[model samples]
Structures are given as structure tokens and as C-alpha cells.
Target: MDQETLPPNKRELLKQISSPHNPKEESLGSSSHKPSPKPFWSPLSLQMSIQEYELLKEDDEQCLRKYRKQCMREMHERLSFGPRFNGVHELDSGEAFLEVIEKEHRLTVVVVHIYKAGVKGCEVLDRCLDCLAAQYPSVKFCRINAAVSGAGEHFSDNVLPAVLVYKAGEMLGNFLAITQHFSDEFLATDVEAFLTEYGLLPEKDFRAAGDEADVE
Candidate 1:
């Protein structure tokens, strides 16, 4: 195309070609035409410096450590003392049984041994509970004479040595004549093992007691 009819870009190219070639001048011209480099710090990086980031990360780690320590302290306190129950109590009337299981200790677990006066197994269970009561003071242990307690209607000669476990006013376990399930010679440890397996009792105390006994 004629110079006058050429496109603006072509006209510019022709002018560059016609100009005298000087390596020093060309190099300087090209460097000036190149785009300026980006700044080292972005807008976001300027907003949050490295020191601020480090401080924030450190605060978060401290909070996490504090929360962990608080949790561990609370758990240790719970395990140290646990729940407290006086030794085995003998219920005299139906009202007394109701009070122990429903009203007075409804929020706690109540283990009741229903027994007849003549059953030998009942005697063994009573002794075992007495020992267990001392070992686990937080768990309520009691006995209701099948013949005299107002709950006599729920018991009979066939149901002697029956054990009922209640928590929060609900029956969690109903073991009828558990002596029949184990040998007549079974002890409190056997009863503890059975209850632990059912998740009714925490197992840590048993292990801790064993450790203490071994050390002694």
C-alpha cells in the first residue's frame, strides 16, 4: 500500500525501519517500553504482615492448649472421687424402697438385692454387696426383704436372690437369681465383672484398685 494509504501500525513499522539503527539506543528504548515489574508485596500481603500472621497463629495454639488442659483437669477430678454412696442399706418398707429407687436417688444408680430370709445365696450376695459398697462408695447398694418390703408382690420363693439395677428412675438391669447363672461360690468380683461388661459401671476404678492392691 502507498505510505499515505497504509494502516497506522504498518506506517509506524515503516518509520521504525527507516530510523538509524543504534544498538545502545535500541536497547535503551526497548527497556523503557517494557512493562514495569509488579511490587514485591501484594495488597493482601500488605494488609497482613508476617509478624501479624505469626501472632494470630500463636494465639490460636495457646487457646487450643488451654482447652485441652481444662478438659484433662475436669476428667481427673471426676475419676479421683467419683460418686459417693454409704455402705449397703437395708430397706424396711415399700415406701423406703420407693424413696431409694425413685425419689431420693433417682438421678443416681440404685442396685437392689431382693432376697428371702432363708436363701443361702441371698446371704452371700448381701456380703458381697457390703464389700462392694465400701469399694464403690458412689454406687447405692441396698437390700429389700422379699417377705416384708412393700415390693413383696414382685418377689417369690422362686425369685430369691434377684437383683435390680436402676438409673435415673429406669430399670437398666434385671438379673433374676443371678446365683443360678454363676456357681453358688461366686464372689463380688464376679458380680463386678458382669456389671462392667454391661457398661453399667466404669471400668477404670477396678483397674486402679487392682494397681493399688498390687503395689501394697
Candidate 2:
């Protein structure tokens, strides 16, 4: 084909005219054009700036959904290896307490073991369980009543609402100090501070908790 109609072999001609024998410029051309491969650590990455996290976190619903999934995964893992709490099971003579009281962790669990005796029993247990589940993953939180525990056999239908915390099966502290009408704020915040005082819990572990993995 005539030169006018022919397509140019740009690389070849550039090589020829630029002196293919010249080592530096040809290498520069090659090196400058080729993209670099990404590093391997990206799959487990935290290269994002705080500004980026704050920006993305603006979508509260999506952020919350992501967090919930992460928490469920961690909870499922704990429950799989061992029955972490008795909330979902039939309690058997403090057998549940055996696991609940023991901490395979560096710290102890300062808990408020509530009994199921009233209309608000579930609400109380749920709020505490979910709160501890998400925010205090390090500490165990449990609820057992006069029906299924060794302690319940004695106080079964006799005791007033109480708050208790134990460390190594020895009562570290308590606030049996509550009466019929009490503030939820005091229950939550006070116990949080108490746990922190004994070094049994983190002030907040929600961020430390794993991202919601698959619950199942």
C-alpha cells in the first residue's frame, strides 16, 4: 500500500527514529506509560482518612445496617464455640451462669443479672443484652430468674429488683440500692462507670466490636 493509505507502525517508527539502541528514553517511554499494580494489603485496608469515614458515615441508615451485620457475625461466632448467654435457652441450675461468670478475657464482666418477674422483664433484658452485645463485647451480660438458677431457688418470688456485679464469683460490688421506681439512665450509666472502675469493661466497645459479619 502507498504511504498515504498505509497505517503507521507508531511504536516501530518511534523506535527507529528515536534510536532503538538508546536505552534510557525507550525505557522511560515504556515505564511512564505502564500503570503500577496495586499492593496486596488492600483487601485488609485502612487507607481512608478520618475525613472519608466521617463523610461516608453521613448516611446513618446504611452505617447502622453495616454495623448490625458485623455484630451479628461476631455474636454467632461466640455462640457457636460456646453458649455465651442463657437468654435464648432453658436455664439449668446455674450451668448457664458458669459460662457467663467466667471470662476468657483479660478483664472481668461487671454485669447486672436481672430477673424476669414483670411486664417490663423482657424490655429490661433486651435493652441490656443488646447494649452489652454491641457496646461491651468484651464483657458478658446475662439475665436469669427465680425459675432456673441456684440463686433463684431461694429468692424466687421474694426479692425486690436489684443490681449485682461479680468478679471471679465473688461479689465485687452491688447497688441493691434500687427501689420500685428508678431511672433507666442511672441503671445504664452507673453500671458502665462501675464496670469501668473495676476495669472489667470498656467505656465503649461498639467501635472495637467487629463489623457485622453474617449472623448465621
Best by TM-score: 1
Which number leads on lDDT? Answer: 1
Once fitted onto the true fold, the runs of candidate 2 whose alpha carbons sit more than 4 angstroms away are 1-92, 102-106, 110-112, 119-122, 156-160, 177-181, 184-200, 206-216
Q: What TM-score does candidate 2 get on C-alpha atoms?
A: 0.43
The residue-level lDDT of candidate 2 at 2 comes to: 47
Model 2 agreement with the true structure over 129-186: per-residue lDDT tens digits = 5555556554556556646666754553335345566666666655442333345444
Report lDDT per candidate: 0.77, 0.54
How does model 1 score by TM-score?
A: 0.57
lDDT of 1 by residue, 1-216 (tens): 689999999998898888886556787776536578989999788778977989999999978866776676567547645456678998888889888777644446788999998876999988888878876666788998887787677777777789988887888999987788778699989888887788776434343454464464
Q: After superposition, how far is residue 66 of candidate 2 from its true place, in Å?
A: 14
